[model samples]
Target: MSIFEYAPAPESRDIVDIKPSYGLFVNGEWTDGKGEAFKTINPATEETLAEVACATDADVDAAVAAARAAYDKVWGPMPGRERAKYLYRIARIIQERGRELAVLESLDNGKPIRESRDVDIPLVAAHFFYYAGWADKLGYAGLGPNPRPLGVAGQVIPWNFPLLMLAWKIAPALACGNTVVLKPAETTPLTALLFAEICRQADLPPGVVNILTGAGETGAALVNHPDVNKVAFTGSTEVGRRIAESVAGTRKKLTLELGGKAANIVFDDAAIDQAVEGVVNGIFFNQGHVCCAGSRLLLQESVAEDFLARLRRRMGTLRVGDPLDKNTDVGAINSAEQLERIRALSEIGEAEGGERYTAPCELPERGFWFAPTIFTGVSQSHRIAREEIFGPVLSVLTFRTPEEAVAKANNTPYGLSAGVWTEKGSRILWMADRLRAGVVWANTFNKFDPTSPFGGYKESGYGREGGRHGLEAYLDV
Candidate 1:
């Protein structure tokens, strides 16, 4: 007898029109870069998606100069209300072009189409709209009466949630009257390039938004550019440190959203079913590529075995396959490099004596893939519990009491985000206060809103993004 399956319900790849080779978006124009070109491929099938121009020193300089010119002559002189009109146009355009963007994002980033469609794209549009509303209201935002835009912002975004991360950095920067030169991760440069077209379609002023497609070197040049008055980055913590160091003596303002090993704690008093779902979503969503993914699961000792049993049952039902598959709950790991990292760390977890449990799912023949994984019998001292495994991997550690939970959770260097599950409001409040994380969710996990400020504390990096707080990053308060 055959079992039930979601079938091959793939979102049509033909919905997006990817060009043969893409150029850098500099000064509001598609221009060829001086550096060598590299091909970006589909991680699921290892098929060449497009050849992208890498930004050279000259390219970075040109983009920065363009942004500086726009800042000095066009963007800065514009009234806040007028600037808002442009932002509103861009936001509306994003909504109008949502389908094309979503398809392209799933292809390039290897996220499930549903996530790209429902979660990522909507949030992208929402961010632009949210910041657009703030464009003319900077004074009343409580950031002071005369907050001025920073000159030229050099933004570097990561591959995970490519368009969403771009939105997080770009929307607020533009709304604050700053011009920007953005460097997208080489593996996921397509969406950023397409967004450049959206900017042009919106009739945004020339040089106001420039996109450079390249790898780490490209990002380095943009970050180190003398003309860039502000630098904002989202990626690994080690890389964030280098960026911070590069801007240390310079007058350039800097903000970074880096790595995390967030702890998701479940109390015995919590609803087991709700906590299990939240825990699953926390580590398995986006193939667990989230910077703030709840990678560490801190379960109360009493319910540890019971919760694991339920969690294992739920994991069995996950559909992992092609990213374009509408029914796919787990997608391909973003890249071969990322896949290797996840593999190495999982091996380390096993070597450290943690029992590994992986969901039974067949991966595609070609492309980077990893089964949904969790390590049981994990201790706070184990590498799996302490380290940031930015993949669909979870490390389970049990705690006897609330204090013990907090103690084990806070043992890590990362302080990006955490989650708690309990029925008691007072206990929720109590756990939240002592978590030492920047964002703490009561019952849910991985919830994001454009109007809410999100950031990290300690080694997870400094400063916030989203809401009125985000405006401060791009402004001269």
Candidate 2:
């Protein structure tokens, strides 16, 4: 370690004033839920940030009713340009209050302030801005000339990128003239609540957007609600399956962005230094909490040893500590439960004969933290390679040929995302064509844009969530 000591550069927490308790946002008002309130804490310090009300079946019903009312009266009858104005206002406000939202997100979600500031918040605002322009041009979106709104879209987002996921689900729905009842993940609901305040600040019509804060039950209630015409979810594969089952035989249109075990494949012809960086970013970004994180690394046998050495050195430099620290590279795990799951899966990896290595960073004492970890000598059948650990863990497996790489990468049930690193353009295109994933990143990893259509091919879930395709989920042809 270098001798030069850097002073702590912490983001000011004073920027956000958290309420003692928060209520559900329904019909453009803050209302109490039928269920008991639960405390939301910072996973970095294990400090309780606020008591957020858990929505019950009754609350879900009320939200759906509010959304239905808004769809029938305010939102549905509103002209396209009028709807565009409201969404543009929202996008602008998010930018104006970007700092506060970023700080709050880092606090509640235990992701580094840098990530929340640089990645999540910017993308959240951009998604809205991107979709806002589409509000008045639905005819050109290619679904039909006179596409119509599906009343009352029910959206359930995951904790990994709470506000960003919210923007993905809500923006398109609103742009297409549909009202929404959204449920933010239980662990990270603050930014969504703050967004509710943004809606109020924009003077959005009453009942156009309803925000419910709760756990799996609340999500289920929203998904199963009779008045909800379209349901969108971003979370676990298990929960997605359950939601799919619950909505069966109903008229509700469904779109799910669920779990993934993506493989980042590196061929012998790849630029070794760039491939190393891509591997690091693939599994370590957002503490590996990303649903589409490239958890498995497939290296050609000729380059595996050299790549592993460089990757180990890279992982050692990652700093894991307070999320508010601007210099922190990796932050705490999102929850205690998630940390334990990571630990259990790592133990399974070792038991299955894979060699384990972790970063040298020291964790803070009070919160949920998991070091950047890698499992070498991993087989395709290893649990760590197959399962979505959803943490800062990577499993390394080698392939002798391009065909072997493709076969190993596609062996899993997930088809959410994958990465390819190579200098050969023809081989890159060939691999991309053969891969079963929805989003294939050539020469990069984990890059997201609002204009890109993203989702999966198989068990990763169905339907696209961005670009022109996103509008189709909320519109009737």
Candidate 3:
């Protein structure tokens, strides 16, 4: 749960050790890059945490070459059981150093300390443990008698959930025996660098997992590189389109997990308080940085009033402030650019005829923060209802029947995820079948497990990221 009620107890940042500047991790070694660097700030206080190196095109070439060498000689030829040993070691190391990773994640990514501690870091370790069990058992995974690695994988992840996204992309690739050349988002590169340290702690072979830090140009170089065999990206739909075009005629196995404007349908029969909590957590989690966030609330006309009243009350109870505070339900926005995007979209939400109701909260003066916001009297055609806001904003629309609810929910081009709240099991099943999303959660929101496959269709991008399906992206079937 993103929203919490507790006394103020801050997680100490002293556990983390950040260098003044960081370099690229190629061949399990560090390179200072071409001396071009950018500062990654603590979004809570707008304090410059450290200077991160910007990887050049040649840096991408070196990383890819190292990954290829590892795949060709060391990592690929290693026995599956031996690879499993490394994964298990990495997972254990993550659990041991969980506090340090959690603190650095909150400092770098602007999520609350409790969330970074409880939710993301645990999930990151879980992904590794789950995939480790599948390492030596690929033959029985229902793919084929034998499935081979895809060689060098070029992975680019967004800044929303840094360590968790790394786990989602890297763990599966390594389990399937594919070496990776990963490029973490520029805004949040610290955890990925630390993860490179974890690989060293596990005694993972040189060049088996290389991390190159930079912005979009570095990502483009990796995506369009000649020797890279697979491309996996989790970011905006526009960038996903560009990656798809660049690899259109190439042999690179591509997978993209992009944006979403998910709909949360709440019927009159759904428990009001329960549905209220679900709705609030749906959009406000991770400052709405999630790609499958339930931003659109489709309510039954008969219960829309009561549901909305409870939702407003729930929103009022939320505490918004510093990322390090235990009491702050919503933390700082991820970055200044993301803050501007949220503000611009919220303004458009007001202009497009949606009645706005912002939760009362005293935001911190130094950092980027957006209070919990709701829009009632919203039309399906409004820009607020149709677009992905990626902030702490909710758009509510009323519908007469299940058919109308499904119709409104399925109207978006994104088919990443959706939510349904109803007491009737048959109705839940019916709605789940027609929601047109990759994941449909009933009675719960923002719940994830490593065993379940997660991805989207159409503009949300294709190919799954967890379970057995995730293995396909890094393997040759």
Candidate scoring better on TM-score of 1 and 3: 1
Residues 261-366 of candidate 3: C-alpha lDDT, one tens digit per residue: 9999999899889988898889999899989999999999899888887787788788888788877789999999999999998998889888999997788889
Clashing pairs for model 2 are none
- Mind giving the per-residue lDDT tens digits that candidate 1 earns over 1-477? 233677688788777899999999989888998889999999888999999998899999999999999999999889888998988898899899888899899898889999999999999999999999998999999988799998999999999989999999999999999999999888999999999999999999999999998889999989998899999999999999999999999899999999999999999999999999999999999999999999999999899999999999899988999999899999989999999999999999999999999998888899999999999988878888887889999999899989999998899899999999999999999999899999999999999999999999988999999998999999999
Range of the 10 consecutive residues with the lowest summed lDDT in candidate 3: 1-10
lDDT tens per residue, model 2, 1-477: 452345789999999999999999999999998898999999999999999999999999988999898999889999999999999999999999999999999999999999999999999999999999999999999898899999999999999999999999999999999999999999999999999999999999989999999998999888998889999988999999999999999999999888999999999889999998898889988999998999999999999999999899888777889899998889989999999999999999999999999998788889999999999999988999899999999999999989999999999999999999999999999999999999999999989999999999778999999999889999999
Off by over 4 Å in 2: 1-5
lDDT of 2: 0.93
lDDT of all predictions:
0.93, 0.93, 0.93
* Superposition TM-score, candidate 2 onto the true structure: 0.99
Cα shift from native, residue 34, model 2 (Å): 1.7
Instruction: Give me the overall lDDT of model 1.
Output: 0.93
The CA lDDT at 342 in model 3 is: 90
Model 1 bad stretches (over 4 Å): 1-3
> Model 3 TM-score?
0.98
